[model samples]
Target: MGELKLMKGNEAVAEAAIRVGTDAYFGYPITPQSEIIEYLMAEKPHERTGMVVLQAESEVAAINMVYGAAGAGKKVMTSSSSPGISLKQEGISYMAGAELPCVLVNVVRGGPGLGTIQPSQADYFQSVKGGGHGDYKMIVLAPASVQEMYDFVETSYDLAFQYRTPVLILTDGVIGQMMEKVEVSEQKPRWTDEEIAKNTPWATFGKKKDRERNIITSLDLDSARMEQHNHHLMRKYEEIKEKEVRFEKINCEDADYLLVAYGSSARISQKAIDLCAEKGIKVGLLRPITLFPFPEKEINEMADKVKGILSVEMNAGQMVEDILLAVKGKVPVEHFGRMGGIIHSPQEVVEALEQKIIGG
Candidate 1:
């Protein structure tokens, strides 16, 4: 166990990056998530750990910087809000296509375009499905608390390097701005040059006499080669789905109804579960930790045991579709959401469950 400290989610994330010994961080400022870069700059990780922290002129430039650093086998990361993340989509896609390992954090805000700076889960589809063009996937982790915000940085980096793919931490403004107690882990030193050389033979860190120069590019001019690359990516995704599905099941032993949510919605839905229990409603809650390799098997099994399921979110019903697919009509599934940065109360969620699942 590490020392516990009270901190905001954004600050926890930045501090955790420092402890995790991230090689570099490149990001542009955006409201709700700006605190991340601000904290990093104030901490001056460059002085302490030789970590580079740079604020680019634009999100596009920031993500491209991440791509470059990651190609050289550096543990780099970037953070932004919804609109800024949208601008970085092209770079994210290119990194994925090139099979580069890196971390991306999206403290989501409401929007089709610059909607609001408040918290939102509206980017569910974009985060889980391919946000950018291509047959690709990012290992997406959703953090529900300040502790999780701190913890997932290391988890994201481990998974990214393990799979040789990009990883995304999909949170929202509520978690980003909210204050909570977090137990931060001890600091670890960054990889040495010898470690990098021995481990990352494919990285383009200058040609050595021992091996050919490594090239990192998404461009595959030959049709057959491109198809082969796509097939390889698909296989990797399938392997991740098989091995990395993570979720939390609460009070599911004898519940007649279930609540499904993730990230901030999951935190609120837990309160709803307690409220439902007080009213003699045995309502369980299933919180997905990994959005990309979604807890489909657990959800499907719960669908058979429960009479109904309610999907609660901060969006206009994006994740509900995945819930429906998982349930497969074995039990009725309903959606309740508040969009445009409007957060729903726990009581409100309980009422929606009563009307849509219990009463219905």
Candidate 2:
């Protein structure tokens, strides 16, 4: 077993990054997630693993720093809450367009503009859809517990490098601030310069004598070349969708209704499912772990059996659209949520299912 410790989700992410041999982290502090940077600073991982942790002047600067380090084949990460994440979108799009690998953590807060410090799942559209200009998609992982926060840093980096694409850890402030026991992983050594060169031949780690110079940029002036690149990216995305869709199902085989959710909402929905069983409703749950590569195939299969589907979220009906698409109207799809940092309760979810799907 791994070493265990009680920690907040944000702190777990920081510790996990250090344990996973992350080369560098550049980020600006923000509410509900400042603990990420705070933990790193307090731990002083520079001395421990030679991991560089810098609090940049702003969120924009921090994301660009990630772009620079990732371009050179280093394991880099950055974290911010909702507003701060908005600042980093262009950089994220740039990294995606350049086909660079990096891990990004968004511990989401409620917001259209500085709405609240409380948790939210409102960033669903932004994380999975291309938030910035151009056609792009980020591999989004939603962690429901502190243990997942600790575990997903390495997982995000692994997927990032494996596909040469940016990956997002899309959690919220509830998990970010909540304390729980985590089985921390053993520390891994950072990659050497030689190892980096050998593993990432496409990286611009200075001009190598054995290969052609690699230039890292998203800009392609020629229309034909840009179109070709877009097609290539689409193919990669299709491959990811086929191979990486991840979800968890509970009591699904005998469900009369289904609850679709992710992140903190998934945790709540689990309890809701239990409540439903006690009421003899026989509801099941489908919680997406990878929000981008959604478990569409599973959802589609369930459509034929379930009477209805309810998307329980912290935002106004963002993920329900995807559920609707997946079901293709075979079952009624409805959304139940509380907005502006308000977390809906298990009872509320049960009521919503009864009213919106079961009766409506």
Candidate 3:
């Protein structure tokens, strides 16, 4: 609720989770994001706020623990890096199917398989397209700075509970490892026990005390039931598509070209925007806050006014696909990036824009 103090993105996320009254946290240590677990272990939310915090055996165990906690109608969360997130896929799919609400943070590292310990934004498609098996959507928030990481921790919790779905805070090594100023609020109680008992009937605390016995399972054996479940999921996705999209616009009104980016890559893109202006090039940027429920409609509208779109990212071209889909054939859409723990600098992005939009 106040002003900035220097902190790391991982620290901000861990602190934010505690401040927002998270009921439980389950996690496995992964590079970059491991500090989150370290913070929880050191702070001991249980002693201070009575929140549950546990270090799981592996990424798989951690996500399933989140499943158990969320099913019980308690606000829960977990954190991991790229490879760990990949391991959580099956559990994520089940959570989505059951419409359980929870928060997940991926402090991404380079990866196709143990790619590197350095920061990378390569998980764009996995997060946005539903990393697990099934036609499900997760509300994905991409944080570009340490402050945004703090903000997203609380926002993600709210989105999950409001939509009765899982939400992901998609960040990378640069944001996770770098330190920056942050403002965190005083601790607030999230929910009353009465509120939990009243709202969360599907929780698995056993129905022996006159409460209706609730079974938390994603498996709908009957064909008709499965179809109904799918329909319900589709409806939720449509609602999110309409209401949950979030993006940042910078001088787009007079832009001749648009630069699309997110997470840490967008931070560099902002610098490039300033340089483009200095060089007399009219360019703008679209920084997506919600990577899932992508800011497609907004980009589509901009496509009509702009001559071209450039997607800048740490990965080669994951998010570019979505940008292209949004702009379609209305304008030229291209991609510029680096990978394997490398980052795109402002100078590099500016150079790409010159060749692609300003000249060739």
Candidate 4:
């Protein structure tokens, strides 16, 4: 363990990126997440760790910088808010098409168009199901707390390298702005240059000694080949869904109602769980750590035993759809949420649960 310290979620993510030996960072300033770029700028890791940090003129340029660095087989990352992330969707889809490994952080705010600086999980579908004009997916990790912001960054980077794909840390402004105590882990995975050379044959660096002229590209002109590429991407998604699903079960062993939530909304949902407990209405919270590869099997199993499920989210009903699919009509599934800069209070969540579980 390094040391326990109180830090904001965005700052924690910046520190984690440096500790993980990220080669480069390219991003634009955005509300709530601007602290991330500011922290890196103030720290000047280039002098200490030989990392490159550049503030691009636009989110599109920043993500393209990520694309260029990733093409060279470097650990690269970018951070932005909702509208900014929306602008970077083209680069993200291109990275997915090229099968480049990189990490992307989206500290979400209210969306649609310059919605608000307040916390919102409106980008849930965008992060999971490729928001851009393409058929692709990114390995999405949802951090409910500041600690997860630190730990999951490293995990996200590792998963990106393992799958040769992009990994997204889907966070909200609430988590980004909240100050919390976190332990920065000292232990980290070691990837030597030789190992990287052995693993990444597709990297577009000068082919030293090795005669293979590798080209890093996403364009497949042949329609049949593009169809094959789509199939390959789908297979990778299936593998990730089966192997990478992560979630936390709370008192689910004998609960009447299951509460499905993730990211900052789940933090508020905890209070609702306590309240339901006082009322003798057994409730369990299912917090999805890996939002893209959701714990569908676990949710389906819980649905069989529980009376119904209530999805509490900051968005209207993004996660609720996934929950409904998991249950697949086995039991009733309801949604309670607040959007456009408003987040539900604990009592509100409890009220939703009470109405859904008791009244219905």
| Stretches of model 4 off by over 4 angstroms after superposition | 187-193
lDDT of each: 0.94, 0.94, 0.91, 0.90
Q: List the residue pairs that clash in candidate 3.
A: 1-185
Per-residue lDDT of candidate 1, residues 183-249 (tens digit): 9999999999988887677899999987878999999999999999999999999999999988999
Q: Return the lDDT, model 4, position 144.
A: 89
The TM-score that candidate 1 achieves is 0.99
TM-score of each: 0.99, 0.99, 0.97, 0.97
* Candidate 4: tens digits of C-alpha lDDT, residues 131-187: 887899889999989999999988988899899999999999899999999998663
Please give, for residues 243-304, the per-residue lDDT of candidate 2 as tens digits: 99889999999999999999999999999999999999999999999999999989999999
In candidate 1, list every pair of residues with a backbone clash.
Answer: none
Off by over 4 Å in 2: none
Give one digit per residue, the lDDT tens place, for model 3 in 1-360.
586689899999998989999999999998989999999889989987888999999999999999999998899999999999999999999999999999999988887998999988899889999899999999999998898999998899888988889999999889998899898788888788778877776777667578668988899789998999999999999999999899999989899999999989899999999998998989999999998899999999999998888999888799989988888789888889889998878999999988876665
| Residue-level error in angstroms, candidate 2, position 175 | 0.7
